[model samples]
Target: MIEIDNISKHYVVDGVAIPAISGISLRVEAGEVFGIIGVSGAGKSTLVRTLNLLERPDSGRIRVDGSDITTLSKDQLLRYRRKTGMIFQHFNLISAKTVGENIRFPLKLAGEYTRAEMDRRVDELLDLVELGGHRDKYPAQLSGGQKQRVGIARALANHPKLLLCDEATSALDPQTTQSILSLLLDINRRFGLTIVLITHEMDVIRRICDRVAVLDRGVLVEEGVVADVLLHPQHEITRALVQESCPSATTGQRLGLSGPLFRLTFLGAVTYQPILQRISAALDVGFNIVEGVVGRIKETPYGQITVQALGDAADPARIAAAFGEHAVRCEALPS
Candidate 1:
């Protein structure tokens, strides 16, 4: 329901122009979770802020549903922002306000709801975020994850159609991040809210995003389905991110006992197939399976293995050819 068309933005630092985003266009479908990933200084935060016109672009248009947000008047922009919720890396809740009061702050600012309506909405959001029992507690009283739940509840107080998450789970631990991601997935399914998340973590993208766009040096380098991009990344930067995000990985150089290192990737039903056994029995080579990760990106199952061939039969090209013959994908790594 969001369309970003050829948007570019730059900043003038002491008479020198530095671009934060350049020639970027993206379409986020309704009721789907879309993720934008990049390392630091890649402008992920800047791009998400552009969705609500928080950061005005130097060139091009942003359309939400059908309205062009870029051309909206100041008052119009304020009204439009209420329909777009934004949560920050730091749980941006008022320290003095209780959880219930924080959730009701948006409605109060709009001055549209009565006291009874506000109370009902606050409780509803609290329940939605599972922070109902903490309504009376202040932000200081809650844990990191709990504070984020309050932030989420406050963002949804106005029933926003679009949600912008700027590294929402980056501040939490691994377990807390998983819980927050699960909550976001549940929220998307239940409310049919269109979500655009910005993260540097590939794990987050693989876990919940339907589609992903990779950013590097302010340029949109790669964009595609989560399963396709996460499993088989085309860009070097993306491959590095994937390797870092994997459960366990060892470099050929680190082991100091390498000859030919090949990465075998099994996709879909092939991941469930016993191709490895058949290949081992047929080929005259003995394969030493090193690093491996067998898991799902969203819902598509994939298995990737690093093989170190032993003995005089260690031909990387031949092994790759064998995998290709069986319709399995393989890549030979640098020594």
Candidate 2:
């Protein structure tokens, strides 16, 4: 487990102090796929770097597995870094080294494995990343996805319990991104590896992350299970992220078509109800569904339907409250 308590990092540029993170705190559970999401310069990059002590925080404490890493000495910090491996967005494999050699770089640097042992581990890691046949191939010879697999293999070289992925798939195409995400999920399940993935892409988080933290301008706006956060985002930033993941979930005049707007979200038992039928039978409201989509989050029934509510009701608030009681999230839009 990792506990970041009130961590802050600052930089000096031309004699003026600039704050990157301001007293941010978060907890990453063991064997959990946790994500930190934000736009560029939201301090997400700086925060991840702080995990491995790459960007030392000016204040507060960092604890990993009950050890206060923030207070560690130089030698202690080096060992701590080895225990937490990092992967970058660019799949930073050494162009000069073969796939096998790149995977063994960390082990070589630590000087902790024997020749025979290293060879065995390299073979095992290559197979782990599903690149066993590409051991002798150089970075230039492999495709983008293949290069990232090599990067994954190399990151696991030292057998780190925690893996930090800094925008690991932001550069890939959608299909390739999904593939890489699936790989990360597999790695987490197989090794009980605790992964902290930081990205601006919400799809990456929605696909595999168990829980997520949304950061906006260095502040943690929201954090919770991916499904819950996606279905019911508490912060504006989190809502925007979720909306981006499911563009069909949007409200208002859609695709150049002008009409009244309604936002609908279904969860639990209410999701199975024929909402249109219920609305017609219970009230004298007409609906022109502008746009809608039904999607799942972790196999949980979750969806958003947008409809333009028409006609008048004797009790508008009462009807809405009744729908709300059924657990079907609903909101009316203004013209």
Candidate 3:
């Protein structure tokens, strides 16, 4: 597990110190996919760099599996760093090198392997990333997704337990993004790798992350399970991110509902149950679903549906009470 304890970082510009991140503290459990999400200038990049000590913090400690990495000696840091790996938004491959050579870069830098051993490791990584056929191909010869696969392969060359992704899929289109994200998930499942990914997009967080931390203007605003945060966003920044992913999940006058509109959040078995129909029938009322977005968060099913109650069902408390019987949560959404 990785524990960030109140770490803070600042930069000096023209003799003035500007804070890049402040009192940021969070945890990434071992073998779990943890995501840090924020918009531009939110200091997400600074925070991720600090995890690997690429950008050192001005205060506080970083503990990886109970070891304080904040104050390691140069040699200790070098040995320590070999335990972690990093991926980037751009596929940072050496342009002149072939795919196999790019994957061999890190092992060669370690200088602990003979030529034959390095070759074996390179071939292993290419196969692991399912890029065996691209061993001799240069970066220019591959598509964006293929290039990223090679980058991921290179990152695993050191056999690192932890992988840090810095806006790793931002450079790809939606379809390619899904493919890369799926590959990451497959790697995590196959090897039990701990992944710490930072992105501004919530959809990326929703898709692969187990837990997520929300950052806004360098501060940790909120943190929770992916399902909880995405289904019921608490912070304004989080809500905005949700809006981008599912615009229909929004609550307001724009929905064009004349009756009382309530936003209903359903989970697990309740999501598939006929609670809404049964309740409306029992109350002798009718409801029109204004809008909704239903999806699975990792494994759990979640839905945020907007419905307008007509006649007797318009009683907010009664409507809520009826759904309570079936464990379906309903809230009177502000318009």
Q: Give all candidates' CA lDDT scores.
A: 0.90, 0.84, 0.90
| lDDT (Cα, tens digit) per residue for candidate 1, span 71-100 | 999999989999899999999999988989
Task: Assess candidate 3 and give its lDDT.
Answer: 0.90
Model 3: lDDT of residue 155: 88
lDDT of 3 at 51: 88
> Candidate 1 vs candidate 3: which has greater TM-score?
3
Candidate that scores best on TM-score = 3
TM-score of decoy 3: 0.96
Which portions of model 1 show Cα errors greater than 4 Å? 247-260, 282-285, 309-327
- Candidate 3, which segments miss by more than 4 Å at Cα? 249-252
Model 2 clash pairs?
A: none
Q: What is the lDDT of candidate 1?
A: 0.90
Per-prediction count of colliding residue pairs? 0, 0, 0
258-286: candidate 3 lDDT, tens digit per residue: 66788888988678878778988888778
Score every model by TM-score.
Answer: 0.90, 0.89, 0.96
